[model samples]
Target chain A: MDMAFDALSDASDEALLVLYGNGDPAAARSLTLRMGPLAFRVAMRMLGDRAEAEDLAQEAMLRLWKIAPEWRQGEAKVSTWLYRVVTNLATDRLRRRRGVGLDDAPEVADGAASAVERMIDADRAAALQLALDQLPARQRQAVILRHLEGLANPEIAAAMEIGVEAVESLTARGKRALAALLEGRREELGYGHD
Target chain B: MVMTDEKAKGLALDDFFAAARSDLPEPSGVFLARVLEDAEAVQAGFAAVPTAPPRAGLFARFADLVGGWPALGGMVTATLAGAWIGFVGVDRIDTISGAYFASAETLGTVNLLPDGDLLALAAE
Candidate 1:
């Protein structure tokens, strides 16, 4: 089983998916290790709750495992599909927990910082999150993929299941909104001239 | 022209992004492990459930036979079934209506004239 996991670790995402489809347990573990952190991080940023992020990540991985049998080769990157699932799940959670803002979310376990640094980081994260929250769900997802995840426009388009032009429009509008929201507070967020 | 303006906006946005990226704290190792463990548990749950092999039942097999012959076999079968049921229903209704109409006609108490003629006569 260890050797199987090692082999699966070396396999491409598509190969792992095929193995997963064959009900290989090691392949499932390898795929989870490969995608778990990414899904968790994206969920954390999108949902702003570590516990919920963990739940969403687990749910997304379970969904991927369940759908492995139906996966087609050369359709889309497994990571992109996972991101889309995590994004949609986080969006659903956000909608369900309406009127609950990120500030109200419990802080991460190791989130302690010096007073000054805490203030700065908190202000920045809060401003950025607020701007993100104001965006339409799809636009927020587009911005997160394009800007935060550093995905290319084409990849974002694929992850979003949208046209390239639509991705471009979403990111453009999202960035504009973010900039407008964060403009005057750049210095307070420690983003001013060095 | 607009090129310079776009470049300046890009630069400003990049700086803002760099700061934002730097401010994001790394997730704790414990948190990361917990996430992985949760994912593994979920995968295990799915693994525990054995998936049944795909098989067609008796009714489905019959459907396949009647549905497979030609391009329109399935459609023809469906259409014929629908038409047959409809014919049977209409036949029943016609029989009932005919019996009632005959009874009324024989009694000479029923006039089958058009409503327009009745209305014209009433007006007169």
Candidate 2:
């Protein structure tokens, strides 16, 4: 079973899509394992709400499922396609919630850390998320994709449907804005002792 | 104490990002299950869509019904020819059959009594 899962994960996304189109549960499981967390994390970082993020993730996966049968081979990587979908969905929510502001930052965990340390870390993360919320939607998306999600600039460009130069500009300006937003709050968030 | 240098600020921002990365939340079980459920639902929908079987043309069915292309053509030709014979050829053949089988005058009727040689038949 381990080997089967390993093999499934190793299969190309297109191959998995074909399997999924044929109603293979293993394919669906593999796809969820491979892309689900990424989608959720992206949505969470973009929207800063777990429930909304989960919804967006499920929506994106549902779209993927819908397109599986008509999914052309070698057209787009599954990750890229899913990232674009999540980004669009998150951007829509962001537009809808514009001026309504972000909800409270979610509780994040730091394994093997002392309780006090974990609290500080969570605060820092929350502070970052709040600051991310302040940026323009595109800038926030580009920044998160580049820094937190670790997608390369080109991949980020594809995900955002923008040029590499534009992605660079967005990330640069976003980082500067974040730095400005987060400058004085570092000590309050418990980062100075680090 | 707030360290106020560009480089120091950059380091602090990097630290925040590191913390964010480290503390990022994974999808819960319920969320994963929801995604898989959606997948199953969509796939089931796709399965439910009825696909029409490939249609065989009349000639193709006929070909299969007979034996091969040549035989199929031959069978069609034979049927048409038989129909033509029944409709047109039968009338001409009927005239020939009537002429060939027409009754001729009987050669001659044989006399049952011999002339003058017949004795007076006594009534019995």
Candidate 3:
């Protein structure tokens, strides 16, 4: 059975999950509406492919559903859990690409984004993505979770399943690597004026 | 922890991080629909029902194991007969199952209850 959305709108994500666990279909819908896009965005940024990211997002949400019945509240935010799951899934996919095309990331459909769209969005965003694609998976995860996702070092540490010190070290190294990669594109990416 | 959280607020000092935040993609409506579909599908399994009744209890299971109440009644009747014979002594057991011993000349059978007296009593 389902509860009214108006009544559940103010409920926290964890509360919605509990309601979903209690067999409320509307709670699942509410959770999907609230957290699905965040999961999709994280997956997209990690995988750089729309379709794959969507699949990963759906997979991660399925995990969320399966865990709802036993979810221990007050442990962590649902977003933090999604960050961990999506990065782990994306990292697995990236690892499989090791021998195949690790050195040469071919242009997928997401890579074929029009220059107008790229311009409409920030050039630095695209440049950062391209540079991020070069770092090893762990470094990319650390950097993305730290910088772009705006997670604190400890939260990134939790998501990456590493020590806080490791997170800091990885983030620092990743930043330096990204800087080196983006150095060549400074003029085009709107950094030359500085 | 408070120090770290405070430090975190000062994050994205880099211009690149700001740009990436601004360029966050809006999830396509189609993808949102697919996610909703997935959620509903998962929840359907959670909420769907066999509508099954409660499981049979031990006595009911034993009753079935013994071939229903009719068989149970037959077993009960045999038990009462055995108890009556045990109270009266093995020599008072019915001759139907006493064939081997009754064949001996030394052992003879007689009715424990007099048929004629019971008939006479009933008629009176």
Candidate 4:
């Protein structure tokens, strides 16, 4: 097991995907560890539901597993590819929601934080997620990928399958919309106290 | 007061965004297991290694060559076997008899049978 971990540590995601295609269980485990949370968080933030996010994460990972054999080395980062999958899947679900929004609060695990800090973080994340859900799907995706996921415009563009200019436009508009939605809720969100 | 309040609001928003991103949610063990299961299911169906049985017949070998569909491979093997038995098998029989004819004169010269007797046996 340690040897498998060692073999996986230095390997690139593409190489790990190749290993996975060849039925290396360690590669799948490594990919799940490395990419699962990212997919989960993106889906959770985008959809504002834990169960749906988990489903999307599973679907995206399943697609990755299916495509591993044909995955082109160095053509794309595995994370980026999963991001694209999650984005598309989340977007499809959003469309199917038809504006009947599901306002389920996101599930956040606060490891090592105090009770008060966890409450504060959870409240703030809930507020941000509410604001995020109010934005258009494309704009919401762009903002989540940019601000929360910390992805660059080009990567966001690739994930969303849009032009870089479109990514910038969507993110700018989305942030402005978020600010508008979140502006007066400072006190309610515990931001005024801070 | 308004300018100060605006600056505070901006700072608060920044803080909010920061706090929102600070801690990501950990996927539950069940969720991770499901993802792993998905990977397992997909990997099972994927041909990680070529499926060639070394001692398999021509059709099975061909099927393995073309990506290991046993039914299709079996059909191909049957077709090749039929062609070989029907055409090449007859040709081989004719060649064996032709060799017998080519050596007949030398063998018959030993008078194992009289000329007319040999002719009658050859006709038979």
Give the best candidate by lDDT: 2
The i-RMS of candidate 1 is 3.8
Model 1, C-alpha of A144: deviation from truth (Å): 0.7
Q: What clash pairs does model 3 have?
A: none
Q: What is the TM-score of chain A alone in each candidate?
A: 0.79, 0.84, 0.86, 0.86
Give each prediction's DockQ, rounded to 2 decimals.
0.13, 0.50, 0.31, 0.44
In model 1, pairs of residues that clash are none
- Give DockQ: model 4: 0.44
Q: Estimate, for each residue in B1-124, the C-alpha lDDT of model 4 and write its tens digit.
A: 8787667766766766787798676788899988888887788787545687558787667777777786776777899877876876755645665697775434214466678998899999
- Regarding DockQ, does 1 or 4 come out ahead? 4
Candidate 2 lDDT (Cα, 0 to 1):
0.81
lDDT of 3: 0.78
lDDT of 1 by residue, A4-119 (tens): 88777779988988886776767767776777778877887787667777778878877887677788989889999998899999888778877765465443233322332444
| Superposition error at B47 for model 3 (Å) | 2.0
Interface RMSD of each: 3.8, 1.4, 3.5, 1.6
**Residue ranges of candidate 3 with Cα displaced over 4 Å:** A1-3, A100-121, B1-13, B49-124
C-alpha lDDT of all candidate models, in order: 0.71, 0.81, 0.78, 0.78
Q: What does candidate 2's lDDT look like per residue over B18-100, in tens digits?
A: 88999887899999999988887888888799989799998788798889898978988999977876787765545655578
DockQ of 2: 0.50
Ranked by lDDT, the better of candidates 1 and 3 is 3
Distance from true location, Cα of A108 in model 1, Å: 15
Which one wins on TM-score?
Answer: 2
Arrange candidates by DockQ, descending: 2, 4, 3, 1
**Regions more than 4 Å wrong, model 1:** A1-5, A97-127, A191-194, B1-10, B19-124
Worst 10 residues of 3 chain A by lDDT: A107-116
